[model samples]
Target: MAAGAPRIFVSHLSGIAVFDPAGDQVGRVRDLVVMLRVGQRPPRLLGLVVELATRRRIFLPMTRVTAIQSGQVITTGVLNVRRFEQRPTERLVFGELLDRRVTLTETGEEVSVLDLSVHQLPARREWEIDRVFVRKGRKGSAFRRAKGEALTVEWTAVTGFSLEEQGQGAESLLATFEQLRPADLANVLHHLSPKRRAEVAAALDDDRLADVLEELPEDDQIEILGKLKEERAADVLEAMDPDDAADLLGELPTDDQERLLRLMQPGDAADMRRLMSYEDRTAGGLMTTEPIVLRPDATVADALARVRNADLSPALAAQVYVCRPPDETPTGKYLGTVHFQRLLREPPPSLVSSILDRDLQPLDPEAELPAIAGFFATYDMVAAPVVDEAGSLLGAVTVDDVLDHMLPEDWRETEFHLDEEVATDGS
Candidate 1:
């Protein structure tokens, strides 16, 4: 090892392609194997867990790694074909470190470990933990707020935290990720292996899992869904926005979808069936059945109360639907919508119908993707209601869903250019 070796965050090393000295591809890095040692020093990297083209996983000792850089790891063209197994003393970085909560010894505040920086020990073929990037603030409070820069604490400043020691197992480690936005959490989950992803998914509550599942790619969504027990899967599906759940169900084989739907609450099953009835690219298929609804005579105060629901998406909460009797699905009649902004300007006692957007038309449930896009563009609305031939409100399609459909097929894969700029020498 050379002096002043580059310090790379462990996350940057994850998923980078591995190559042999002859320039032949080996396999991508699955995880780092490390052994914890006593004293003030950090754990030592022992080997690389590599998953080959054959779908077989094997171990490549650190001695076989000739070089490591931003986008690839160079090996000496030698590898052990036998499978990699976890030794009693070793810990997998990707499985164990990324989101573990560790208390800051100085502040006595708990922070989630976001990433770990590791570097080669001076003049030796060994790497040890150096710095840790941790996010401050408690869980639920930070989920919706913008997170500031991570506090990079030297490894020694962290103490008395271990999954086994805390007796929380995966739950304690996953608590750190509880504060991440669903989309951000989905991105991190995408990079993990199937097993690790399932472990984390199991740790999340239904609502959080539903939100994250909606953000993940269809294949990933299906994989994680398959891992859950039937009843738990039903609970997660029911918690998801109906449209998102329907979209996911549409991707699975009919028998599996039917089985899972059977386990769901009847009302939720009915809602999903209604969504599944429409063409995937149509407005009905892309709309959520759970928009804030109100009776025509309801007051601004009532509308405001609906807007306060924490589970409602921002777009869905931005307006309230006014209908005749039966505010639930097949909403008795599509009276009109009252923009939340309009409610603010009206007196609290004023009826919602008084400020309704009478001229704002709803989209037909069968409207095609292009028509839906035009509706959003022409009306300058983040969400629009869907109605049946009889003018009964069915659901509301949000701008996020419309944009999701408008994006290219490989949008999610390209969104994170993990290969382009992962590793860099800290200045």
Candidate 2:
């Protein structure tokens, strides 16, 4: 909780009233609006948008916030309280200037504001805004004319408000990950700043963190890990699939990688290190150590019980591997896999072998990328088991790792991508 950061009780928000410095009751707070500022020590609070009488709304500068009490917001100055000038074109609070025309200093060309992003100065309380978007207007315009010139103001150009002037005590109404689906969380993460993202990640428990991390791209995983403390990072990594942990650790510098590994429990670190020893593109590199394995002679009821009781990873495939007795060498004898969906559709007393798919195609530890890809392409496999030459089940790889190799870089630009556009509106 750095100084000047809004102290609104985000979790306990409800029935919180907002008042101006003049002590006039404006309205109850509907939500606390926030803007993400990357690389900033403490992310900036752009302003607070309050819901007022008759569905009216007003944007109050963060500067006017005075105090954030349990049930009310206190402002340092009186707000106009009149209905805000409607700007439906600027529906999004972020990059509000997008689509508006502005003049570029060097090129002297009129460009449509496509996006606005925030960049924070490390170790400082300040933020710089960046704008990005496609250019509009004639090619040779000496002086570019700004569309809606009044709204093209840069972030720095506005300086009338003070830290305490923004209406204080309004709470954030955004849903937590537990409250949102994974796809929804993905969408929200795209909109948040790095610092804000860390806050959101910190809120998740190890289980949820594991689920979310698997869904994020490798680059995003690295970015998020870079922002977290070593302890928190270790917690997240340890909870993830072993192969994912190895991949993420491999992305960091030598010192950072070692430091994080040291922070992990010995068992967890050893497993990750073993996985890291394999080439990243190989089957050995992508396999997870925690595959669901059971004895080949086990009854379907027994196997089903284990599946129900086991704390399976979120990335678990629909099938459970069955091996012969002496579980350690089950992959050697190669019993087969029981498709969970199929088992549920059959009688409970059926033998495991009756439901097993014996024609499974296994991957050798030393298999090359092209061979691995072709195996998946030929069989339409969702996951494949990796085995040693002796047929010992070493681990298993899912389709996700292979897909990562095929995707292009920069497929999804982060919310921070628009930082330049927002910065252009400097004081």
lDDT top scorer? 1
RMSD (CA, Å), each prediction: 16.3, 17.2
TM-score of each: 0.60, 0.56
What tens digits encode model 1's per-residue C-alpha lDDT throughout 1-427? 3547788887877778888776778788999887654333576777779898898787777766778875899986766667776754468887877677778888898887777887887776667778887887654221123365467888878864322222335575466576677876786677555666788899888988998999998889999999999899999999988999999999989999999999988999999998999999999989999888899889999999889998788999989999998989789988999998898899999999888898998999889999999989998999999989898999999999999999977566432312222111111
Q: Judged by TM-score, which candidate is best?
A: 1
- Score candidate 2 by TM-score against the native: 0.56
TM-score of 1: 0.60
Q: Which ten residues in a row have the lowest lDDT in candidate 1?
A: 418-427
